[model samples]
Target: MKNIILSATLLAMSAGAALADAHSVVRMGTEGAYPPYNFINDDGEVDGFERVLGDELCARAELTCEWVLNDWDSIIPNLTSGNYDTIIAGMSITDERDEVIDFTQNYIPPASSLFVALSEDADLEGGVIAAQTNTIQAGYIAETGATLLEFATPDETVAAVRNGEADAVFADGDFLLPIANEDADLMVVGDPVQLGGGVGMGLRETDTELREAFNAAIQSMKDDGTLNALIIEWFGEEAATF
Candidate 1:
């Protein structure tokens, strides 16, 4: 009995050592709800733009990566605590976030966008448009004074508009495109607001190696058409903004 216990302890230690050595395998975070960017699919897999981007970057970096679902607002705090090496949800890069965490090269270009159900009564030109709390679109909601509502997730925001709980939703235009396509009643109400924006694999201030790998791999994918292909498939058009 003592021999068996000793062997179990040794085996546990060995596994721990391997996990610690290749920590990258366990170092990824994503929203897992922002569909077409990163979301939990029907098969119970977390995937989408950010998921694929992280996968490619990990492959290029020659490291194993594991993705976990995280809420957007708490994503940074989790990263700061070393809970994740990078965040790859549909997170937009903003100067505000730069102050807290480092981000890699842009993986997705940003666009100002809004969605509304295709009801004849829909009038988002000056109606309420909800956005996920803390997103750039939140500022637009405030600026427009269009009855800004704060939702914890994009899915909720879309639901609000769908059920007429809200008039519209402001978010990443490209991300909205896919949702609109899936919903026959929803449509992008206006031309996208092109702006200086990009989504990156977010990293902690000290995780230089992981940051470098993500940045390098993103550039490689951009140059090789992989990013564009994914964008077209998800957004139904080649994504613009560098």
Candidate 2:
């Protein structure tokens, strides 16, 4: 019986060690549909501002890291379930979200949220506004007098406006600015609305050590002005930083 007990203890230790090693290899979760933040390039790999920022953070933290694509709706739940170690997606830091998960210091400062539509005369107050489900934009729209239409993906929200299912789509200015600039048919309307605290890396509440490592890395980038440079590279000079 003693020998059996010892064997069980040894097995548990080995399993624990394996788990530790796996945790050391940070898995960054992102919604590959959000451009200028993260998206799948033509090469079918994660690329964008968050991709670049996440890689630098991992290098500074001395972590072996890999990117994992997750749908925006399930991103947080997956992180809490240990499907990934961190969410480097351009997720805003909000009080509601903080109740469920911890966030690192702000990497991207809060920026304006904009409304885009096929026409400049689109009604901003009473018209239908589409936003990605479970986003701060969705929450903000819900409070506005405008009818809020929620979609699962950012692309779908934009499509809703193009298809005339919604009068306009509201989202991060950084994400929508380039789209509006590129498409002559689409235009940004009304003044931009600033929402949320800022964008940050998401981690499970239990993963305090992992959060600290990322926070330190973020601070390092901020101190050296690398974070601001990357923000401008992807979001242009108008984007808020540090």
| Residue-level lDDT tens digits of model 1 in 1-242 | 55554453444344434444646375688888877787888899997777776777666555677877778879889889977777888777888889898888787776556555666466666777778987888876687747888898888888888777788787877768767877788877765665446777778888765566566566666666677887777666656634
Query: Model 2: per-residue lDDT, tens digit, 126-229?
Result: 99999999999999989989999999999999999999999999999999999999999999999989899999999999887677767767776777678999
Off-target runs (Cα >4 Å) in candidate 1 are: 1-26, 119-126
Report the lDDT of model 2 for residue 105. 92
Shift of residue 63 alpha carbon in model 1, Å:
1.1
Q: What is the TM-score of each candidate against the true structure?
A: 0.82, 0.90
* Residue 42 in model 1: lDDT: 87
Candidate 2 Cα errors over 4 Å, as ranges: 1-22
